[model samples]
Target: MPSRTEAKGVEAISSDGNLSTVHAQTSRKERPPVDSQDGWNGTLQQSEAMAPVYDWGPEIQGIILSSCNYASFLVPIPTGYIAGIFGAKYLVGVNLLLSSVLALLIPLAADAGVLSITVLRIAQGIAQVMVFTSQFSLWVKWAPPLEKNQLINIAISGHLMGSFITLLIGGFLCQTKVWPSIFYIFGGIGCAYSFLWFLLVYDDPIHHQFISAGEKEYIVCSLAQQGCSPGWSLPIKAMIKSLPLWGILVFHFTEFWIFNILVAYLPTYINSVLQANFRDSGILSALLLGAACIGTILGGLLVDFLHSRKIFRLVTIRKLSTAIGVLVPSVVFVSLHWVRFSFSASMGLLALSSVTSTFCQTGALVNILDIAPRYTSFLQGLSEVFAYSSGAISSTVAGFLISQDSEFGWRNVFLIAVSINMSGLVFYLIFGQAKVQDWATEQMFTQL
Candidate 1:
């Protein structure tokens, strides 16, 4: 079973494998993906499963799958600086090319035994970050404002789908001794995506000739209302000082910590602790992720509905979601200590906890865009940094805690996760608000 970090940044379709809210600058020579028919608009028009090009056969598909996992590890480290300084186009281009190159190296690295499994994992992690970040950045550039939520959901769903397919089908493939075929398949797909991406994708809508004038007008108007500039640098200080940014960071950190622990380690926990079979573990893992997929879409719809009705502000909606979402799972974690049930019953409790907690994950992701539309990508990257960092910590700590037990003992780990979830909820309620920052407002006024 892959760790949560392997599934990191699996939620949103932002350039960083997380949610980022930023405006894309455009030039006539460089059109953004949103503007092209094959961009976000085109993608969302189809089913979420087939939205991204994840169907390039088993080997390449597995590479893309692993790449998705790998990117979750790599995105946060370099995404913010790259997007902030170089702009989204170069960021996307460099990342796409780099990820493909590095991914192809995995086979060679393995055959030569030049690196340990851990080091090879790290390399895959780096490639995952680059590829997803680039893909997300391009999506942000091309996707229209009104469709942002749905499009982002679809984009992120690709990862969920990937995980689901891998678990369900990967085992069979491996049983057939075609395991290496997975990586080879993904490598070939990566090369193909690079070629098509270079030819079809642009930096912004204004530069794309294929986009009609009416479509551009609709996009511009929608973005304006969402606090985005069509093609300008963001007010860096305002974004830096925003309270919502910090709120999002904390929220995402907590959500990812729980998610990472479960997704990465749950299989082992079930097998080692509950003494479940491999098939059972795989099924439970898929259910956990499937719950997350459902939670993400439902959470988005709920938040969007609330925002539309003006019943609560976006920030308040996010807070409410986080509180309810985190609170439920924290209670479940505590209950786990008392439950003397069969393994199936335990799995039921865990799956329920996962489904509810996932609401917080989607909420925090959408909030990144809500709070800082101008620098959504960079801010999200910042949040990813913290989220993934927590994931690394959780991974190491969970391993240590579980190892200390002679038998199936995960009580300490659950207690720790419960504490983290509760703390995140409290922090969010106390400090998180969706309104634009005072400094950002001032900066906007000054610019005007």
Candidate 2:
């Protein structure tokens, strides 16, 4: 990705968008003076004219967000199971509707203080889990065997793009003095999208009202060969013992640990350490995640190409993508602390690292469908349960590390994230495989 100097036109948006100059003062009493002698030009005094809408401080803000993150996977297992049993179309629709309504009320909740905001965030987290659950369920029926990687990766890319837009637009809005506009606008978009989702999408091709007979027949036939049916009972014992399944869960957990840190803290690093103003910080952050969006699409294409050519077995292809995604980025994350003092270098490493990490969208994220298409939603929920549970620790740790804004503190954060990333790689290498598991087609055993 190009350096921030290359990003033009942001000045126009910031200037026109009610931009407020943010001067972040060191909130800690004992923090040493920045080495003004080091030629760094990142800090400035707070603009007395730029009054904040709320002054919850960093600690309270961290708790509110962390509380939300912790709640994200709390109900996914049951939620996914329910979606699988009853069908996902309406469940997903309702989830989004409820979440959007809550989002629109966030400004009101925030004014009521941390307790209200925390309650609202936790509720939103519960609702948001349905989005992941329903999509995985839909994929189990929608994705053709040969096109699985490409199809799923395309859907996953939406997350990267959404984050890109959020950071870009959200930072600008935060500067606009009417910070509440952030929630209102996005919430409104979500509500509108939910209506379209219900009208256009269905749980399966069999149920899609508008699908052509030939297309529905093609889909039903393909999935029938895989032993997919309406049975809701999952093979709990076999799933618990499956090495490949556990590998997916462990690696997903580890990967999200690093992912959570980057999502939650990168903007802070840019704003606090690099002393970049709000507009520049938003642009820089969006640029890195935009690279991530591109990486997801490219990785999907490469995976499908290799699969088509028979260059390697599916298992090998998955393992190779995992290594590229997790291992390379692990090294890059560790290198980030080394380049922390250099704006372009640090941002460059982070951008490269995040993009590489997203290649796992084609690897680990899609591996569940390969192993157990019949139970993909349930397995996805199980994996997310582990992933989000592990990820929730990251925010708390970040809060502790950057609490005093010490250089060594931030360095330790990078080291811990690197260690987690590498650990996940090792586990996945040892146990991961990308073939159909026997339990997924249980009827085969009884019939034989």
Candidate 3:
């Protein structure tokens, strides 16, 4: 098989038959070269790409987002198992180091002509899982209950931003033949951020040196009000057996299938069906994800607002949000079959549908904490296992569908996503209970 660069070159030739390799090289020579002083530096600059143009708050927020997003795609399967069997701290350190090492190795692998793209991508996926899950646990520990929704939104929004940025920037990098540079830049920045995170983030607010006494008291009290017991060990068996866990797991699996199909495969759809360029595809993908980011923040705020008013109970809020989120998107997806429109119009509808779908994720995603704070990491791991497994299956099936099609065919794939999401929603509606049941209440009271 050809190298990634060679494959891209071949694609360019295939797309534009008039563009010969020789002509391309000659054209490059005639064009004004990028200035080193201007910070072009022969590759995309991380600082420059998203510098003063982006606000500092969002930038830091982006790093946190990228950290989670990186983990979502980059962390290895082995690292996830390690996190399950051991603890998060070691997994965090190991994944960070491993990702950096892989970043350094990308060029070497390219040079040696032996790096299997599948394996390289899998390594990245594993590292990403480790980092994000670890950070999630830390977020749960440090954030006050009243602020948990907002904090969780911020962290997950990081994930959304990371996905958006990667797709947006990765496309540019691929177009410019600097794809490997993207990994190097992200890896280097991640390594540096790992150090800063280690120094600044503590497991709990009480352990944090910089937090004010009043802040600490507020955090502790907030957690208590949320029914969390400080220093409690996870009720591993009970969590595993709970109906809520299963509901969340099923919901996560469905959402992830939808997310992966859209984020990973939509660009290809745009390229094939819309006949759009890489830049346009990237922008469209970013728009879809940007909608998700907005949806998640809004969902969190909506839940918090509801809680503040005491109009709806927490459990009621979670279930209702989750139900609408899944149901509405599924209906929208089905409607796509009837509505014939331009590519841009279709994408806009898809984005709207996706935003509605993502609202469910905020409630379902945070439910693990409500049900079992002590085993939040482990529960997240379990949910991730189910979610990614479904995602992997969806991606493979999607690829198969695309390959078998003679013409642009994303309809079947979207149908599959819609079906699965609707099925999950039905399952939750039938079996998912918002309140802690009698058995769980009895067990908790006994333990107390």
Candidate 4:
């Protein structure tokens, strides 16, 4: 796999759209509220000073714009469960290919109609979830407990780095005067990556034609007691009843609420708060993600170091990581507006928040593997259902508050974030267990 994996959301693209506004007035044909049979040239007016040429007000505009998250909200558990049953190889590869193709076709879809683009994005969302749903399943066969933090962190860091580079490059691409170049570049990369995925990666190392025997032996031996593979049956009721699982699920919801606002609206937030230009907004966004990428790797290493040395229980380390990640960011966020008096101070503060928040990768994010390696993939899928839902609503919530209360808008958003984090932290501290659940590994349990 490439060191960086590209994951672009429609909301991200929409939020990052043309930062420069037209000061010049022109006699132009305004687009319909919802495009139907609009030509590609008509879809985006290169001269239109504001965002997308679509004339829909923010209300109903939510339909086509947000279709991806709504669709993504529907399929995670089933996709995750299926990936657990079948090997992750085809699931990950085929879906990535499908998503890339959809991405390339999005411009054409926009030309067709608002409905056309909405349908395509919905399909892309479903396909991308299949790719995401397969990730933990791959780790089940490949990663040992001791190596779990570093390995998973390294693999997922690709997501962070990809977004960092994408923001930087996307900003540069915006300057090229070719509006569609970003889509073409990333879509092409996704296609190439998918092809390479099929050629080089496998569900398990043992299945790979090119793997050395010693490496396979090491992986299998390391995972022996931990039960490296998944089974056919699932204890759904037990999972529902588990408080620790709920801890992570709640954590996922709140975490998504907090961080997604950054991903989806950071450029706008920077533009509004700091009065920065698009290029400046892009640079700061990239810097935030770069910090997160570095911090994820370092946080993983720190976690493993403490656990390996017996300085604390793995569970204790997880708690500490979660606490710092949530609390520090909450503090900074509460003061988000006050600090904006200085651009350098604000950027420094945001970078700090981003770095600390990646510790969740070492904390609640990895706790699924700890408590239920057998059900990690399926559970992850289930967790992300909550995650994507919160992520989906987060932007709407922020946009609404911002629009309605211009003076207190961002402050309200930050306070809401702080409030959610504090509550989630309490729940997780009380119930977030690191040991494998009894139902996850028991052999005498009746199959449902």
Candidate 5:
């Protein structure tokens, strides 16, 4: 199975607007026929090199693939507003449906050439941004205070799992005669899940058809105490002026820079530097992400446990986890260059970096709920604009930085990533907020 890292790399290609080099190969020599009397298989195998059929070159490929990330810069903010006004269930459902359809159409788009595929990827990016905005919007209505980190962390961890499953399975599938099956299988699964989501999930507990009466009442009463209610305007002016909000944006942006570098290029690093074959590269990449999944779950549990016991104040815990999660990884990432001669050791360090770094899922990610549960979705959306934008830049930037494919080029990329990660941590440590903002409640509006 391909690793989650490889899956993430693939997603980076699709979502972040990076072009994977498609080698255009010459026709393969015909294979010797198997003898019918020898009990050999009779089926003719398709050559793996026959796929990737187009070689648009780096320049054209980058322009086309990057449409997804560039289009993302326009979608999340508006989608968040739409989700807030119209409710998230339908928005999420529609986004899923669109993404699924786009996935299924990739082969056809590729056949039609670069422009067609680029347009399709742009549409998919639009759908993806809406999906994230709407999902976080749903959290505004659904997550209870005590369980906030746990719920959000678990939900986010599912992304890790999805990445893991896709990369692993896709790796094996890519080596098969039917490489296109990777898209068909995953897209079909997404379509099926969308149907289930529509049927089983509700916008809020109040409207849920199957939620127990007691549980619904408990949820309503809990939210009421925290001044969570519909009809609150999205405090646009306040959000713009808030230092803490900007802190979150910085945190998100810097964090994703490192993330983009890894997801988009880790497999390439393993292949080019470590000299691992395609299959091994995929497996090693998956192991790194699998470590991240573990870290996510453990980090969430640690936060919730500390919160429950009041072992540390909420702000303290958030900051501490962010430091531990982010800083260690930055250090490990820099140190990776020194150990390049030992492939197994380098892989181990990479996995450790991923594991420790994922604790941020429980830190700043859930911090949105802490400070502005009412506008968690909007806040997350706003931050994601910066994050995805940085993600896009990182891909382009990495391409330029590593153009030489030398150790010097790769080292510079890691150093830049490390520097960004540390800077974000410092910024957030100084300015990050955990207290619920006054603007989240009715009193602030009354004053307005």
Candidate 6:
């Protein structure tokens, strides 16, 4: 009997090597292997080089696979606050170190048993939370307003490209007969990255000795008028009352819901529905995510161009980009149900969705930096909670639905994701704003 280490295989580490998200089933069908296009059964067969096969049912599988996110939910708020008070530099570096070390140990932990692997993954998740929140915290001072979209999207695109490397390279690695090399190689790279980060990354342009005086002055002056940095005190009451904050939160939830669904279930869909093998599923997922990486860079450039040129108000830009991200994906997902019989068609739709959804990278995502740079880190933490909740809920729900009936289960998942996404778009369009809020200014908080 294979232990729960099989569940660890479900984790998808982000490209930067700093974050990991749970999704996918590595279990192949055992006994009578179900026909690829028909149903799913846990595969209990594997060569000695690969990890042991486990027959975890959908319920247990969902629980163990998503355990990392459970820990992620607990860390973001406090860490984000701390990072604001102290600095994100040490927080991010330390978290990445922990995550990298743990990745190297996964194989040994799997050999130990279920408890070890679960605990290790949870630890890694906590690290992931800090890495995410810290970046948003640093961006409070590190990124000038004009460069917000391009800089942030480019940074995030690193993670996507890393994911592309992980998936595509992982497929080839699996074929090498030494599966654990996947962890050893990536973990080593992450460790190496930590050194580069400590050496190169600064909390702000003001602190970087290598930057030119003119550039630093430009960066500082552009940001001088805004109260976007983390403060000693937050306007909790005002923030709670603000529709724009709520709008960003709701939009984050919606975006995460759809993204998480794809993250957690795409491989299962490919295996059970499309009948593709593990390697093929990974290659396809990697390819689609690569498209998203490209889309993110392009969208950021487009959004910034429009904003810089004064062609649209910041609010209008957000709403327009967000509409494309939401409505297009919804349509594609719905179309998926109709065209699912054709494997190539389904992949193409998913690829399209992957690219279109990235427009929100500039929309709701960058909106926080615009409206309240002061609390961007904390808000990102708040949003992380929402993001993790949606992912956890959606992954479990997906498991339940798929268990009831494989075909209809997927249809329900897509429809549910689409409906939730649409409502978020509506709320954001009505309430989301981009101009700096009065309460976000240092004077307003001090006066209050």
Ranking by lDDT: 6, 4, 2, 5, 3, 1
TM-score of 5: 0.87
Model 5 regions more than 4 Å off: 1-46, 53-66, 446-448
The deviation in Å at residue 127 for candidate 3 is 2.0
Q: Which ranges of candidate 4 are over 4 A from the true structure?
A: 1-66, 111-115
Of 1 and 4, the candidate ahead on TM-score is: 4
- 442 in model 3: Cα distance from truth in Å? 9.7
Task: Give per-model TM-scores.
Answer: 0.73, 0.86, 0.75, 0.87, 0.87, 0.89
Model 1 clashes, total count: 25
308-409: candidate 4 lDDT, tens digit per residue = 889999899999999999999998999878987798888888998999999988999779999988888889999889887886787667767776876788
Kindly report which residue stretches of model 6 are placed more than 4 angstroms away from their true locations once superposed. 1-25, 30-50, 446-448
Q: Give the Cα-based TM-score of candidate 6 against the true structure.
A: 0.89
Q: How accurate is candidate 5 locally (lDDT)?
A: 0.68
Number of clashing residue pairs in every model?
25, 0, 16, 1, 3, 5
Cα error, residue 255 of model 4, in Å, equals: 0.6
Task: State the displacement of the C-alpha of residue 183, model 3, in Å, after optimal TM-score superposition.
Answer: 2.0
Candidate 4 residue 1 Cα shift, in angstroms, is 8.2
How well does model 2 score by local distance difference test? 0.68
After the best TM-score superposition of candidate 2, give how far the Cα of residue 198 lies from its true spot, in angstroms.
Answer: 1.7
107-142, model 1: which lDDT tens digit per residue?
455444423423554554665555455444443455
lDDT of 2 by residue, 1-448 (tens): 0111111001011110111111121122122235432322322222212433455455554566566566877777887787778877788788878877787887677668779877887787677767766667776677667666777676677766666776677766544434566667777877887777667666677766666787778767877786665336777878888999999999888888878766666666677677665556766777887898788878887888999899988989888888899877878877877777798888778877878887788887679888887777788888888877876787668667777566777788878888987888889889998888888875743221
TM-score of candidate 3 relative to the true fold: 0.75
Candidate 3 C-alpha RMSD relative to the actual structure: 11.7
List RMSD in Å for every model shown. 13.6, 7.1, 11.7, 6.5, 6.3, 6.7
